[model samples]
Target: MTSPHDALFQWTFSQREHALGLLKAALPRPVVAAVRWSTLRIEKGSFVDRALRSRHSDLVLSARMGAGRIYFYVIVEHQRDVEALMVFRMGLYMMRLWERITRDRPRLTELPPIMPVLIHHSDTGWTAARAFQDIVAARGPERAALLPHIPCFELLLVDVSAGRAGDVVEEALTALGKVVLWCLSVSGDDARLEREIGHVAAALDEVLRAPSGLAALEALLRYLLATHERLSVQKIGGILEKAVGPQAQEAIVTELDEIERRGRAQGRVQGRVQGRAQTLLEVLTARFGSVPAEVSARILAADEATLVTCTTRVLTAPTPQEVLGDDGPRVSPARRPPARKRARRT
Candidate 1:
């Protein structure tokens, strides 16, 4: 119950197939080749401290390699700001895990290897410290000479931001896995998610067609509902109907209706609307920095209906004025970035 983001991240990757797919994609080629995937099993642990809990979550999985076991410590960062001290964070997580291992095996001689991997996504690409050495305070040739003496570890980063999503090769991922990664990649941008809805819908159809899809779909829909403040249920329903058929749409819409009913009965509709106004302003600021005072006032004064209209145009609307323009909140054609021509995966 940490958040929708954590809920989805844990539920999806806990399954062996999804976890393995991501492991193969993110791990070193040699590590992939050596891992006895048949022996792979998830380890129960949480190394993310209380302060980091809101923005970060970790998954620990162990697999047999040669005569011993190796750990894959996967950390997913879902918040807006990048952690500048990510290297130290990774080291701390590894240390905590190792502590548990030592406690369990009191007579252990050699420590087991733990490879730290990060799955980070945000509005913009990563520009933080990538290596442990990057965060060191000392500099110059003298620092370089002492580098070998300092305990250092490099984190394997699988940055899945909007700008870097294309770098991910989806050929090996399952239908659900593909869609989860897809959702994570575009989680920060309503405009990007809008342009990519067709792709998502097609992928989601595959997930819903299965007999056991409802539970998984519920998790997915919940995540989208919580994250995308501007994305309307009607539009989501329409996309579902077209891609997966009406039955799927109806199932989801029914759940949504119940949520609205509860909100209305509890008289929390105004509070929800106010929260949406704040979220919308945050989105605008994250994308285009320092929202104008007039724009802030307009958002604060707007009702739920007015906000919905503005949400649709907020992505493509060039200026803050266009977001709440006199013309109205409607989908204006956005100049899409040219798609990267990827070599077809064999």
Candidate 2:
């Protein structure tokens, strides 16, 4: 199963403020100073290659400069593995974005500039080429001569693996950025997750003070419960209670109960619909080689949609932890971006 990191990473950036803050912090200081963060806007309905949607997940955010004539495209890459042809893929996506701009403004003659930023979170650090030209095969002077024809753009790479947990969480400009980077850093390591709960909880309290903080807190709690297997609902809720307040703890417990209720209710219907359950069990058995009783029991009880999601993830997920998506306290909210009204358009 694919790691839930993709979904969680996308969710964190879906917030306009979080996206802006992360870009400012992750980019160079000089670059950050030049842009008008106030004008930054996430360009919705701007993705392409619909048929290859499962290949990757990306975010396209735009901000204007110089009387709105110049714009910047911040394309975020959140894949786990490094793609050597990333430059080519970025080039293709940029071309599609430019085409989209021209279609929207037929009178324009020049396309706005775009800065591609790749947010990589692999266990191993990124060793791939940063510039598109690096991937091109040409020898000696031929490479220099062809430089004019080849794309020379350099993508800003934010390697999550290359930072200390303390520095990243403490220094991140946005609360959401801190939360995400911290989680990503400790994703596969339950020991680190437990050790750093105090720090994470402290940062979360700061995030919880704002008006929209509760929803963000809820999302974070859900993300933790889904991804961290060693964390129990009581354990997580206790950490949150100590860090935030009893209110937060109670909310988390309530959500946990709801998820369990839904899962079991779906289980009954699944038992009656033997065909889909059988298919799911077969897939699980093939991958895990005799699924554990508890896990098999869950499959027998899960709804068709959850089974489908698990099946899709099982194809690439390395462990039952990933296929189940959440092995801790609760199931994740439906596999979709959190629904909220768009912020004011730039």
Best by TM-score: 1
For every model in order, what is the number of clashing pairs? 0, 4
Q: CA lDDT of each candidate?
A: 0.81, 0.69
> What tens-digit string does per-residue lDDT give for candidate 2 at 177-262?
77777777666566767777676675666676666766776677677777777877667666566766555555556656766677
lDDT of 1 by residue, 80-136 (tens): 768789889899889999999999999989998999988888766678987888798
> Per the 3 Å backbone cut-off, how many clashing residue pairs does candidate 1 have?
0
Which residue pairs show collisions in model 1? Answer: none
TM for every model, in the order presented, reads: 0.71, 0.66
> Candidate 1 versus the native: TM-score?
0.71
> What's the CA error at residue 110 for candidate 2, in Å?
1.6
TM-score of 2: 0.66
